[model samples]
Target: MTATLDHTAAPLIRRPAGRPLRQLVVPYLYVLPAALFVAAFLLYPMVLTAWRSLTHFDGISDPTFAGLDNFRDLFADPHFLLSLRNTVIWTVAAVIFPVTLGLVFALAFSRVRWGGFFKTVIYLPATISAAAAGILFSFVFNYDNGILNMILRGIGLSGLASRWLFDVPTNTFAMIATYTWQQTGLNMMLFLVGLQGLPPEPIEAAKIEGCTGWNLVRRIILPMLMPYVVITTLLAIVNGFKVFDLIWVMTQGGPGRASETLAVTMYREGFILFKQGYSAAIAVVISVVALAFSYFYLRSVLEQEARQ
Candidate 1:
């Protein structure tokens, strides 16, 4: 009876209060604020935009449900088709030119003396705002008295000095050149950072194996740098698709809309023409395209990693 009474009086062997519960809850609590913020801002806006794409509203008027009409109209619209073509061209150019040039310069800079000075000089262009770069290039591409034309005349290549921003294809290419000049710096910096963080032991070992200069790079270095290359190329492509400010400041989708990209067309539709629903549709399309590419890229990387 005394033993039974002592057992009854003793503390209950229940799980300790608070500790395990807090361990489970505290982590979620730490993440709650960020989750709420993303839900409110990004997720909510995305859902609302998708809804808006299915409706027709003139900003102030009550939105009318239009189902898939907006998407159908988008496909039928010739201007949108042209803009898509331009977007493709820009994406291709951005991925190829800037990434390649940046890689070349980064490798060269990594091996050179006074690399910091050269890096600063090369990366300076990235500091300039897109608008400023566009404005600067406008003057550089000016027809008759422009520095580019003057240089061409000086160097006996005057035939190559046609109105850079006047023709359709030429204007688009000229704009791309301007973007490449600015974007190269960013890609170069990214590559440079990757180059700096590389494990030096492998490189040193390769040197012992008579792998010097290009041989070292082609064999040991390039494979390791593949991740950076992929990232740089992806960013360049995305930026190219989303390019607006620079193109707007430079071409304004001019030369008879030859240089118009999807972003330009979307802006013209939504703001200039006040087709809110149409614009939302365009936004959805752009988002879809970007997301599709991003998803595929990440999936590919994951698959490749898993295989390795």
Candidate 2:
């Protein structure tokens, strides 16, 4: 019996003498092109931008070392301060309104017969480019002959309609509303995917225990959908931080810098005003904020997923 066991185990434990050097190096060779691409396009540009931020380059002139002066000047400028504030507002509102509305729509329409039609109509806006959407909303928000104002007059609520894109806070809120309309459908689709992919056993078990309506959703459904929630919220925050095209097309960050976000400010500084260093500084700040959020949130998500 001992001889029989030894013979069987020796056959099972057979090992190769060595791997060929080419086979060992081939995996790394496969990864080399992608690594080079990232280094050239992403990492090199990031390093260059950071270096530019520390200088006084104005696109035409040679760069002169400026240290933190650009940042200091940004804090002192009222327009920059306003843009920062607007960025904060945009990030917060984007996270709240679109995400919440999307989840709500997903839940409400998941079982509806007309859900497909509703989704198509709602998601159509998201398919349009940001610039195109901005142009369309500009016409819709026209002060005089816009459809919104026309509808308001028809309903005898003309007072409610104003220069949507011309006022201070109103312009900001109008743009936010437009963003919400465009974003909500995508969020809804994500949540709907999550909902459809849910494990049915827990839901069936919950229902048998008299868990229904909001209780069932709050207790069982939501916890399972946390991944989608994290994803949409992160996307919303990043998009909010870097929003420029829509604002540029709609208002050009004006009626006097009222609706300027960080991205718009950076563009105005670098391209329009020829302040390359200052724009680079703004770019660095935006990158830092976005990276911090992504790193911490993704770490936490990984930890949670590992435990599960």
Candidate 3:
């Protein structure tokens, strides 16, 4: 023998260099358009906004560095406080109601025969544009001749028909209700997808072992669905903090800043008040909050998946 090693112990020969180079280059090429788009649109704006947060640009004027004055003012601003409060309220409401109701409905749909029809009907409202929904609800909640008030008066419960969109707590709750109604479809679909993907064996086994109703859900379903719950909660918080279009259309951050969230505040500061730098600061805050929550949520999801 010429002292050659066993084939299994021998190092493999490398592929031709040009072919490898071409393969590598092709993948980069495939991603080039998306990379460029993200760089130009997402990265550039984010970097610019971060820089602007330290400036004092008023849309028309040259941006001058103002150190942390804008951030300092952000803390003491009553408008900011009210907006934060409302954002917290919306976020809590979304988490407690929509997520819970969505999970309930998803389970019901999974077990029901007519789920498709019900899902379609429930999700139809979500298909409507938020702007259109706002306009429609504006009419629904109108103080004088609105549908809600009319129904209340017709039922001889006029005391409960007070201005839905014009009062403080009522306006905020009314908007939250509308948001929940519109959002139920998305939540339902997400939960349904998660439910359908679950290994049927565990559910069936649990049922066979006398685990039914809330016991099955509490012990088996909820644990598996924790990932989805975290995801939905994260989305709700981000959406709550960023709500603008519908609230703007319906209340214009009004009834005296009662319904304003961070997004509405940013819009008011940037466009209406012409405080571009300040608005950028608010934008940064929103991004920071979203990123923090997303980081934790994704980490939790990865951990859960790894365990599975």
lDDT of each: 0.89, 0.91, 0.86
Q: Model 1 off-target regions past 4 Å?
A: 1-15, 19-37, 296-308
Candidate structures ordered by TM-score, highest first: 3, 2, 1
lDDT per residue (tens digit) for residues 214-308 in model 3: 99999999898878877777777666667788899999988888789998999999999899999999999999998888788788768767867
lDDT of 2 at 92: 97
Q: After TM-score superposition, what is the CA distance of residue 47 in candidate 2 from its true location, in Å? A: 0.3
Cα RMSD (angstroms) for every candidate in the order listed: 3.7, 3.6, 3.4
The order of the candidates by lDDT, greatest first, is: 2, 1, 3
Q: What is the C-alpha lDDT profile of model 1 across 156-197, one tens digit per residue? A: 998888888988899999999999999898999989987987
**RMSD in Å for candidate 3, one decimal?**
3.4
Please identify which of the two predictions, 1 or 2, would achieve the higher TM-score against the true structure. 2
TM-score, per-candidate, Cα-based: 0.86, 0.89, 0.90
Instruction: Estimate candidate 2's alpha-carbon lDDT, on a 0 to 1 scale.
Output: 0.91
